[model samples]
Target chain A: MATKRIVVDPVTRIEGHLRVEAVVENGIITDAFSSGTMVRGLEIILKGRDPRDAWAFTQRACGVCTTVHALASVRTVEDAVGISVPKNAELIRNIMEAALYVQDHVVHFYHLHALDWVDVVSALSADPKETSRIAQSISHWPKSSVGYFKDVATRLKTFVESGQLGIFANGYWGHKAMKLPPEINLLAVAHYLEALEWQKEIVKIHAIFGGKNPHPNYLVGGVPCSINLNEVNAINSERLNHVSKLITDAMQFVNQVYIPDLMAIAPYYKDWGAIGGGMENFLCYGDFPTHGYNQTDSFKFPRGIILGQNLNEVVEVDARDPQQIKEYIKHSWYKYGAGDEAGLHPWEGETEFNFTGPKPPFDQLDVQNKYSWIKTPRWKDKAMEVGPLSRMLVAYAAGVTEVQDIVNDTLARLNVPVGALFSTLGRTAARGLETKLIVGWLKGFFDDLVTNVKAGDTTTFTKEKWEPSSWPQSCEGVGMTEAPRGALAHFIKINSGKIENYQLVVPTTWNASPRDPSGQKSAYETALIGTPIADKDMPLEILRTIHSFDPCLACSVHLYDPDGKHIHDIKVV
Target chain B: MLLLNPEGYMQNTKINTTLILGIGNTLLADEGVGVHVANYLNQKKLPDFVEVVDGGTGSFVLLGIMQNADRVILIDATIDGEKPGTIKRLTPKFSKDYPKTLTAHDIGLKDLLDAFYLLDTVPKVILYAISIAPLAEGLSLELSSEVESAIPEIVDQILKEIE
Candidate 1:
């Protein structure tokens, strides 16, 4: 009957610094505040630099989704200069992007988000033989043998016995909220370890194409890797074969392990299908361009906005229309030139440090004031949720038969209604389904790339319009992509050959933002409202919803601190 | 058995290549010290078998490169409640020996080491942890003066490790 505030600062297993405060009344969260505590002056650092070199610097925004920033940065420059990349280059970029999606989603599901569901300590009690039986019953993955599971169980036992949990140290093991039985928990634990190894093999595609993973190389006009049948250093026949094998391996794992694992785990936690569905409006700047970047119809994932859970009428997304996508910092820790209440288009976006909240180690945030470094980015002044769930729902609504079939089949299999597809479990399931869809598309892209190479089309870069002299004196461009977390856009204003101003509104910035001038709560905050907290102290339920968004504050807000001395230090355990 | 190829450079005749990996964000002030030290070492004429890579906050991707090497020297920014620029060199035998948190990535290099340990492919690892102030909200590309001065010593420590 009493209102109590519970805060989870620096939510572990997420990419960057995030602090969440929720006021719980009668074991239900009534109000919530999401804050991104750090500021990365990445946009500030990009000013006055050559627009061509922007990818190398901007790619450092976050380490996990490394290549997405590079891709978006190069695309931004390309869009500004009006350079159409070669078809071969387009196919190669698509494949690389697909590889990143598979790798990111798999890692997110197993390593990052899975711990919130599967209790690691409970896995020690699971019988290896029973776990193996359940694993085999679910999926046809080859490592589902009792002997293999026994070995995995032994390794996990040793880890638990060693007293040092390492990455698994702070998890709320054996919590009342953990739903999985010991056998299923052991099965998930086995797959979690397998996924770590599986991810390594998938990233080799990036290394083969871009010369490295994490921060892969990208060019404005085209990709950097050239297809040469004879050269050892280039993307030759031998390397292409290896890339082909890796795609097949990734596809098999997604189909055999990832999707099966999601389905197996979804039924147990179907209650989550009714929780954490925030800001039903969804936005996606469709990706995987078949033609050039300008042609939206050629995109595999079509660009659109699905508002208020209305799956029937899908509205077209116009990134160029300044009114459609504007960031409001009314309640964010940023000051706008026009005033605190005014919304600014990213081209005219400004990053001014204005920390107007209580200092660190505080009990509660001044929720009515500036609370987060992330500004509320509204699509036509409406808070829009962007991620796999949004993308999948939009695709399904648009009658993309593949997306529709996957969503329908998944819901049917779980025996949950269509309305249930809008919650936290739905978000997690959507990521798995999207990975499955992307892996299928990767095979087609790889085949198309091979076909282009066989036709003696070795062209990868367009060198004609690369020089600054060939450009207009002033131009503005918006580069948008469906990053692993969600919709990511980078806006660039170029003068002569240099970047005059740059603004990036990443995916998490949309989902994890604070309140706007209209006093509307962010997607994360809205999702947290009415979330039943089983335990106020452990608050694993709050983490379940937040982790579902796959929050990456580094990508959302770039740098921290204007004054070098007063660093906000909050002790996180 | 050093041999000269067409480029006429002395190549290391040793079979096992020692990878010197510098992992951090170069755009972040003191956090980029490992990359700075790596770049400094890259300019020097080291052994051909000694490869220098600026990993730049990469997590599992570095495992492929790490597994290929017989030994590795990793340099990154670490905060252990030490002075801002105090350089600490350690030979970490297990993942627990590595710092609990890293500046840029959530699953730090320690997680990667744990994976390597699980796979039984972990190489001999030596770390040069240049102490930066603990994770905070400040922005600068230039390293603190103390961190900048420790670069030579850090590189020296890495050179000694490889030798």
Candidate 2:
């Protein structure tokens, strides 16, 4: 048997650059790697700049998820200053976050991830009438209008005719792995175009409140904009209702269209689950609050720290543990102090550029750590994963009845028992379900804003004389927020009222990270170890598993061209 | 050259197909001349279809703009290898790397002519480059003897792009 490898450097459609490499032996994946290719010196740029400007600069690291970075940076500042956000501020932040989820999830499923499964060429073979019937069957999304579908077909036709293939150039259409019949593909294709329009409108919700969709402005103490009675009323009645309706319609579409599509496509490609499912270790910081805004009291999705291949549960980990979190710059271009002293808290951190290749594992684990700019993040000397699947699994295990029912019911439909819902597919499905639940919460948050307005307390903006000296000096604080991908934290120290040092333990740092000092693999990398590399020449299945983590490389801003540098000479003709 | 300003800023002339290329290093310090100029052009409210780009320090990229423009004006901090502030104007024919060390940010411009040649989408091109001596790190521009004196002349040349 012969093996072939197919590598697509700079995976298009997603924000930033991604390089995917798969090792295939006899039509099965023996190995795979998802490499982040772009180098952004955000950490270096942040050094010596006014701490307040970090919110502006760091957020631009990745335009797609800039909101998360901004919120994380602001939270870090708040933690250092030791100022408690007002209740209104909490509610506003929660609403803004919920809006981001609605926008991000919808866009990802339709634009970026959908291309993996939906075949556009197959859509051309579909009957228009049948396409309409299938779309209506899936959900009553207004964008699923027949006229809109026709327009989509026309635009796609022109795009293809133009021969530029802007977004569709890299897609694999004729592969045997494409499972859906022509009509279903046609329906999905139509929805994909409709999704583009719907996403544009949905982004308006971000602009209305936060100033922009990709990156939004949020004040630390409160939101930048004040809520008048009209604005408060409009937020719930118009903007939020529109968003909630989209969510409802989207959930229905997933149930009626996506799941059925996934199952239909699964048998044609039964080898996926076995290939890319890396180490079973899962982690999630948790989202949604049952009652209050306090991080500790609002809601607790039981923390999970899985050890080894046994999948055994251990004690919950703390976010504030400095010893648990260590950064090894040995392989990175950034130089650090001698071994065991390489790790520095965010406030006292030093970022110096030094691009070198792989080195020995930092901790004492027994695995070969290789590839990726993201450092392995451990919890109390143990490598733990972080993302939606982890959060869903922890919630389901703790018997969060809402998520449990959805997972169990979905599993029952799939003919698998409830226990099987603890796997990768379950984690992916949980993200969609969580979006539905969060949409409901957003409606309530909007309603409460109106209530606060009626009580004559719509005063949301606060302008105070802030002196740098007033903020804490020489103190460590953990800033955590549930970024769209997972939990994001910024650890920092302040000395002389300036950022003495800072460290960002981002979500991808946990998911796409390399192995730890103990030689324990990062969650996604560990998951990849057991996955059979199928059809190395066509690594779509491998991509699905990797993208499920939604890795963000901009946060880990160091890059190297190991394959030798010959710029592709991109000509914009 | 004809200058036509919509708001009477250029009431005395007529402007057509003006390609105002702003050049600078967005990541590098004072080298962001193009970005600042582009931002100013965006706010100045030019006529329809006027193209303005944050060209940064990529000269090879200028070939594309050069091919397809009625007129082109470039804004950059030039370290002429002359006196710090001296401004020089020469119709630089294509040398291997006309603008040596084009920044990574605007490297896209390096392949401009190649794109036009392959795609057959060439247009009439013109260029106006400025020589700001100091391209240091930090937002503020540090002008040398001759480079500082060239700002007014550069602005006049930019207004001339529309003319």
Candidate 3:
């Protein structure tokens, strides 16, 4: 049989413009290429800008995870100037960060990644009473009554009969790849609507602390919000109480609805546990600092590297070490000062355009050459995978009791072996487990905030090194944190209080990056190499593995054009 | 409970302010036209009831802002196979009324509008689609000369809408 190339340009339901090309031989992908089709010069724009204002601009890298960039950017400047925020400020940031993680994970599972698994059309065939029964068997979510499922079924019927699927239009409904029963599909559909309402309420936490949900205002030294129990205008007792309540609500959803649904659905797709395991080397910069930023022991998520699925050894990760973390653009559409093939540390990173691939409307990418806008970031000169799976595995290997207990409990419940944690299903399950752990941490952080406020320590800002005049003439710092997606780092070079250079190696870049100098395929490419294509036309299988990583190519690459004039339409047909 | 206004100001009562949201990435050349237009509008002395926002690329976070507003004017880059700087005005009642391809962050805005529709909180939405060349590389903070020249006209159009 002749090898056919399947290309899915502008992968739907993702954060940015991405093109995936797979070579199928005997209905199996033999080779794959993941290309970030956009390029925005954020690093170049940050040059000569005030270091303090970097967060506001850098956070624009992506619309989905805006807070993560701002958080990483502030930490980068704080690390450079040796500024430690007040304990109260740390607590507030932790609460806000945890809120983002919970909200982002839930949104990803339902809105962004769910349709890849649950067939929306099949829900119309579901018996609402049976769905209600199934929902009750899992957990005690209140919206599981037969009447509720019946209403949801009617809504699904209306949406289908309307002849306008809206968001569900692009889904490969009734495809052979979809394995969920109609009753289970109806249950997922009901939860999907519930999640939408739940997310809106959860973001109130961000609004309470940061003053906004999407693009929250952040100062260089501390959060923009000042805690004041007496002042009605400030983050008073009323608002604090509201945040606490929101956290409880979010935790209930994650515990009762999200985790139970994942467990119930996992049994139907156990075969996924054997597929989409790419680049066994995992990386996480460990986030949620309980103490000062410099104190590594205080981080709930530890920074380390687990190589080759070897749970026995965990290596320490020093993000600032140039020799340890470097980016190569040999197969990317950029040139380096050292040359095209040379690897440069992010501190010394350069963004120069050099598009050598065939122009758009072209059939296939020249995968052997420069084909993507994403730079291959190598950790210790190896392509490592980063995300919830990486964070879970690293924490488990480091013997984090909380992570171990959850992982053990989840594996035991699923009746799957420990090795199953290396596959796509594990990646998806890891996100749910991580969310459960973070919800617990969020409750503790909220309690700590309340305790601090009651203790009369309401200070949220430290203006120690805020002014440029009080700074060293030259310095550099690396801000590393575990974003909801994976490990995120912001490298900054400051000269006379202004940013001389700025570079960010986001999570998706590490996972969805193109080939590096060593000619090793990226995590996305390697994961797709052996994926069995039930139907090349449907390509649901491809979307399943890709969506497992929750690819945010917009955050990975900068912009979406190689030429200055031509516009390529994303044709769904 | 106190609500955070668009300007980060604390208001005693909920303000049914008119939101002028510019959604796009400024670093992506012409794609940032909406943001540029919003910034331009912000500089001008506008009515107290109008709030100009540079929404950037974050879509979900803007839902609260949209819900708070009585009316909304969204400016973004759209590719309708027209001239690079051609400006098209649309009052999108449904998500389907918007262009199929809305720059790189189409899902954010399109999906957001759908959510608003489902919740029945959708305000009167007037979109200014600044048709530009398709997304390709060559990143710049400056909008294309053609698009830059149309800013005054676009601002005037928006001013008239609010007036």
Candidate 4:
């Protein structure tokens, strides 16, 4: 009967740290506040540095999105210096980006988000034979034998009974809102383990090209992998073939395991198709360039903005236009030179630390005052959602035939209307659908690279403009990439070949930012407003909506607090 | 035609069975002591089986390296009310056995360990937790002088272990 405030800090199973504070009135979320607990550590680390070496450091900023960050950083530096990459280099970069999408999306669904839908405890009681039968009916992924299902159930039972759930430890298991059947849960659990094995293979594309996986090496002018199709220790036919095999494997995994699992899981929770539909504005700085980054029309994802929930018309998005894209520090722990009310574009962005919040070991944030580590990012002073759903909607609206076919086919298969694309289900489904299309694109990029290499053009690097001496005294440029989470971009101002100011408006900064000066909430907070919490203690419903964004606000200081012991993840007050 | 690299992700890095993994954010002052120590060790000579990795903040991507590794020595900063540079060695079998460090990637490391539980191969992992004060304002690539002073002792301990 009374309004209660529920807080889920360090929301588990995400790439980064996210704290969600929801105001529940009469079992439904009336108001919600989302805070990224950690500051953007890279902002201060990257100031007044040589722009050429940024790719290595920026890639370490996020926990999982090293490739995307590296890509953005290099692209920004290249844009600034006017360093044009060879076709082989661009194709290789596309392949790596595409590989990341396949791996990131699948990992998000299984390891990160699937626990919300499929209960591990429930899976323990499932009939292996039935799970195998259901698996066969939906997908032909070879790990669907009855014995395999039985083994998975046994392993899960052993884990659950071990009194140490570890990764599965923080899950709000057996929540009333968790709707998947025992067999389906078991099937999902089986794939969760298998997906981990499959994802490691995907990153080899990064290693083959970038030199390593965790923090791969990157050059400003072009990719590090030089091409020599015949040499044993080069980007030869063997390595290219290896890339091809990874792409083929990814295609099969997405088509068979991921898409089928999504369809199978969607019918059970069609109610979610209407819930957690946040804003009407979506923006995407499209990626996978066919004609190069400058040509938006050649982008496989297609660059554009959809305003007021209009799927028919898309407005142009200009990241460089100082008026078009801007960031505000209001309702955030950052301060701008002009003031809180003024939104500065990325080129003029500031990294002033202004921590003004309640000390930790506290209950809730001062919502009326400054809160959250993420700065509010805006497109022409309007809050916009940017991610897989944003990308899909923009592509589908722009009449990308492949995206349309998949979107239409998915809608028809689920028998849901087009409006359902606005909700939590839509966001989650969009990621899988986009992954399906990207794998196909990955194949095309691979083929194109092979064709070019076979035509005796093995040039992957351009020495022109690679030196800092070639640049003007000062120049500014912006590099945008569609990260697995959303539209991620970096803007840099180079003065005399040194980075005067560097600003990264990441996916999480846009999605998880707090209220603006005008009191407008970002995607994460807005999506949680109407979510009905079945039980206040275990807010499974809240995680469903929040995790849909694939919130990647990581790099939280990994402080080992022994005295101030805080055990619970979701604290309700 | 995926050419099989017998060595794991470390084929790019020096492929080794023994790994000295450092976990931290270099941007933070003392928080990056692990990486600082790893960088210090990377310059020095060590056993051929050992590979020093700046496992900056620990991600799922590091699992590729761990899959091939037989033994891992991890160094990270911890806030346990001890002296700023006090070192504690721990042999953690499961993710639950370690101290609850609060980073999004710390969760990933724990999840990475938990992921190993799902697989048949589990690497033997040892952690050297360096005690330090809580996070402070103003980011710096340089470690605090006090924390920086303790690196030699930590490096000596690591050298003895590898020896």
Candidate 5:
């Protein structure tokens, strides 16, 4: 077979444009590069705007995880302005975020990633009864099993009939990589529809609180909407119960349906475990810190820092420290001065239109023209891994008993020993498991809010009083939040009260990121190095791995309408 | 004024769902015009499943309702080469020749509705189009007077559609 590179530009259903380029040698992928083609300057565009607007604008950066961006943007501004949100506000935000988290994870698993593994065409061969049995074996819920599959068929039919392949258009149903019996495929297909409904329910929580999903209205001081007792009770009882059931159902599905499905499918594609698995250097800024303990302190959810390949002896991340962070744009197309000089806060950043052709694989020294609008973010002089896998690994290593036990059990079950549990599959599992933990955390948060409200905590939002003079001349702080993908950090600097500099080190920036100087590869890049590729064009393995990372380009930078194409110009051009 | 608020900001107002189409590019230019109008209708608490739409481009996307709707009021752009603020209400009869422009995104409203008719999705949807000025530039709409002026009539027609 003649060797050639295949570029799947603008991978569909993802938030933004991305090109997956790879070198093929005799039908094998010798090298691959994931490039983000869109350059969004939202970070810079956000400067000097009423910081409150960040809530609205930042979330627009990524549609999939818009809620996370909104929450984080609020947090970033709150941290910058120093405002302590009310308990109700915190709980509301927590619930909304958790809802989005579950929704996004479910959507990722069934809709996005599952298509790679679950063969859709095979479902035609499935016995609807056996499929129901397969679904039942996973978990028994009150829903009519027969009706569920029937609804699945109807919805699929409606979708096809709608002339909108809105979700499942590009599925490689008959691909060689797809493995799973018809019965299991049908079960998963049914679950996929269920997940969609669940996603709508979860998003409603946002609509109730934030007014809408996908760019829900959040405020710097607090959320714009309030929850009365009736609303709260309704959510706590009926809605929350349903959500809880869904989570539990999902866990059962993971253990029974997905795990078995993975196992059943793994044998056919054993080669995937080896490919797209990058350096295990994970970095988690941590989440759900108690009242007094800073993020560094261990809590129900712990912060994570993995210095190197050895996942043990987790390090602590200090947001106040500037020495540990530097964003290397050398390997990227950004025009930065020589070695170690590329790192700068976002406001003082440079925005130049320079398109250098794609750099060859393993060429870490070149800076002239690089692919991808994504920047290479480094923590403590290293490209650290961020996401559920990173968070879980940190939690497990830091002795979070529940996570540790789950990790151990899952690893033992896989028979690959307790170690490599931090690989591709591990990452996906971590995201799902993290949702379970977050839900519990949020329920408790709601309970605390009720208590606080009963105790007369009327301060849902506090106005930050800042004497213009009192504002620091220049200050830098790393704002870290748990985006759906993983840990997101924004190291911002304000000079004379305007945003003098800003740098967003996104979770994907670490995980799906490319290689950097010193020849250190990104977590995703390294992960892909060892994988064997059968067909370069049909880079299913690479897509699966990248999807595992759940890359969102909008959250990182600013995207502007560069050329306003009036209709006349559009035609002429 | 069409006062399109796809974001649904006006809940106390009166809105009938006889005709609703959301038009806008959640991704591109002042295309969100239809979404704004639909959202506005929604906020005003229009009839359930009011014909609200993001409309995007491709006014023809509304073709399915042409015969079904006794009177269609389509809210869109007015490219009369007039001042930027000019908005106009055009009741192009049910005989087709409706304007064809969708937002820069995929599947124009015309093609979408045409497909619906071709596929028999909604063979009897009437068409109501409001024309403002700008159709390109970016996501945010540049509302013109004619666009704004047509809102009340559009709302009235929508109520008529529902009635």
Candidate 6:
């Protein structure tokens, strides 16, 4: 029996291009390799520029992760300059980030990850009435009428019958791996559409706060929008009310549609609870700080590290500690002035591209050599998984009452133990649970903002240390935040007011990075092992796990055009 | 995954608009042409109906903005191998009509359109895909002379369409 090697290049329905190769003997995967095929020389663009303007550049790295990068970037400069944002600004930033989590997680579940589970073709065979019944049964979300479901099914059917599947074209539909009943598929599809429309409304909070959506404005001292209830130019009462309404709507959508859908879908994929539990170590740079950015104890998510699957105790994480987080290019397409064998802390990190050796063929990856454009990052020389699961587990471990309550309730409902929280199912469930929790936090933050505003703290920006003339000659700081995907950090070094060095260790770099010097595979690769591949040609199972990480590789492959050709499968090429 | 709806902005303006969205990544050379054209038209004293927006990569955030308009005219770069600066106008009836697989980002344009359909507010979608060469340079705002030259012609074409 020979081991069959399979590869899914440019995994669809993700933020960026990712190539995964796996060796499957019999039906189960034995070994896996993850490669991020795109290289974003964002740091190169940031060099020799004003440290204050870094967020605007880094924010362009991903269309989906627009605000997270901008937030991280602005915080980096602020941390370097030692500026404390005003209370209003802090509250607004937290509200914006919380809003992003709610929106990002919902989109990931329905639009991105839903297709991996709910088969669109199977959805056509669904009974709309049954779908409506299930929808009504799951949660009291409005618009679950029979007519609504019928209309959705009819539209889906029309689109399918037109012989043009479009976005739904390449789905591994009707695959044995798709376990949901047709009615449930239809239900998921309806919400998918609703989520799309609903998702668009959540970013209005960004527009009102930061003045734009995709690339919002961020300042070193504080947020961009000034708080003024009377003035038209500033964030007045009208704009604030609009934000308040959006948060309320987000809370409703999360509670009614998202959580209910997760509960309804989990029973069908319980076996997934055992597989895709790759690493026991989890890391989270806790976010949504109330006191100050430096106050980890005040963070809603709680700053900590869980080592070796230990949930009872959480190890403290310090981003500035050179010994804590170090990046290695052992199997990545990068080089170091210090050494390749040893990892370099991001401040000492080099962005020199060294593709000097003989190149592997375009399609085939020589995993033995430098195979990925992503650098391998490890916490204390150990590969730790990040994202919703890590944050939830950390919060749960730290005994955040809401997180603990939700996790326990969910676990009890699903009848799964704590160990299940590490698997693919656990990872997927964690995203939904945290979204519910984050929406509450958003509302809380929104109320806090309004209350503070009422208390006459209308300040949103600060001119304190606004000029670099008051700065030390050289300083460095690691601005860490837990993005929707995972722990995100931007390391910055400022010398003479110019950006002496800038490096972004994004969430994907931790989860999607290739094996390190010690040959320890990162989250994606390790998770894929032992998973059963139902079909060689269609690797929907692989997508289920990888999409769980919400990979944002930052694309660079718009070199050609489809020319009206329908891309049907995960092209091995 | 979310909204940045300038509903308040729309209310403040209080004018029915034929939204013209120029979509692309401005950081990439030709990929940012749509935004460049949009920024160009935005400065011009166009008719009240013409509302130009820089729809960066055309994802869900722009959906709320797009939905606010009565009709939408999307201008973007298309690499259909026709020529470096060939301009092609399309009234995309289906997601299949959009040239996606090899273009800037996956066809979030088409998927976004399909989502619009489910909402039952499918805006009159008109796409002007300006053909450009495969992007080679990195971290550039300068469009190639070929693509750059087509901007005025494309702008004229859009203006004519609006009229």
User: In terms of DockQ, which candidate is stronger, 3 or 6?
Assistant: 6
Pick out the ten consecutive residues of candidate 6 chain A with the lowest summed lDDT.
A557-566
Better of 2 and 4 by lDDT: 4
Could you arrange the candidates by DockQ from highest to lowest? 6, 4, 3, 1, 5, 2
| Chain B global fold similarity (TM-score) for predicted model 6 against the true chain B | 0.87
lDDT of 2: 0.53
| Native contacts present in each candidate (fraction) | 0.34, 0.00, 0.32, 0.35, 0.00, 0.40
lDDT of candidates 1 onward, in order: 0.82, 0.53, 0.83, 0.83, 0.55, 0.82
Q: Give the alpha carbon lDDT tens digit for every residue of A244-344 in model 2.
A: 55445544544554454454444333334344455556665554444432454466444545444333444465666656556654333455555532564
Top-scoring candidate (TM-score): 4
Stretch of 10 with least lDDT, candidate 1 chain A: A559-568
DockQ of each: 0.33, 0.07, 0.37, 0.41, 0.10, 0.43
Candidate 5 lDDT over residue span A1-573, tens digit each: 665655554454455445565556665566667666445355556566555555565555554666776777767655765666766676667767666766667667776678777876677567777767756664544443766776565555555455444334456667676767877777677666555434434454554455443356788777676444345423333444443444454455444543444444444444444445556577777765455224347355577686655656888776556566666665565666443346643434554444465433333222233655667777777777778877888888888888887667655655555445556666666676676666666566656765775576645555553333455666554556787788876655555666655555667776655566666767666665555555544567666777778766644322221121111110000
Which scores greater on DockQ, model 2 or model 3?
Answer: 3
- Tens-digit lDDT track for model 1 on B1-163? 0111101111112237777888888777888888889889989989877888878878877776677676788888876668888887888787666664444355657668877766657688877878887544545568888889888888887777767
DockQ of prediction 1: 0.33
How do the residues A1-573 of candidate 3 rate in per-residue lDDT, one tens digit apiece?
Answer: 868888887677877777888888988989888998546378878899999999987777778788889999999999998899999888888988899999999999998888888998999999999999988888998888999999888877776676443666678899897999999999998888788767877776777787765678787788898788877669987777777778889899999999999998999999998888856799999989999888988899988999989998899989888899999999988988789779989999998889898855687788878988888999878989999999999999999999999999999998999899988899999999999999999999999989988988989999998899988999999888889999999999999989999999999889888988888876899888789998777788888999999988776344343321112223222
Docking class of 1: acceptable
- Worst 10-residue stretch by lDDT in candidate 4 chain A? A557-566
Model 5: per-residue Cα lDDT over B1-163, one tens digit each:
1222212222213333344555443333233445556666766755444445433332221332332333334554323345543344444322223443322221233333433332333433444444445443122323545555556666666666676
- Per-residue CA lDDT of model 1 for A167-250, tens digit only, reads 566678989999999988989888888888778778878877887665888888999987898986688887888778889999
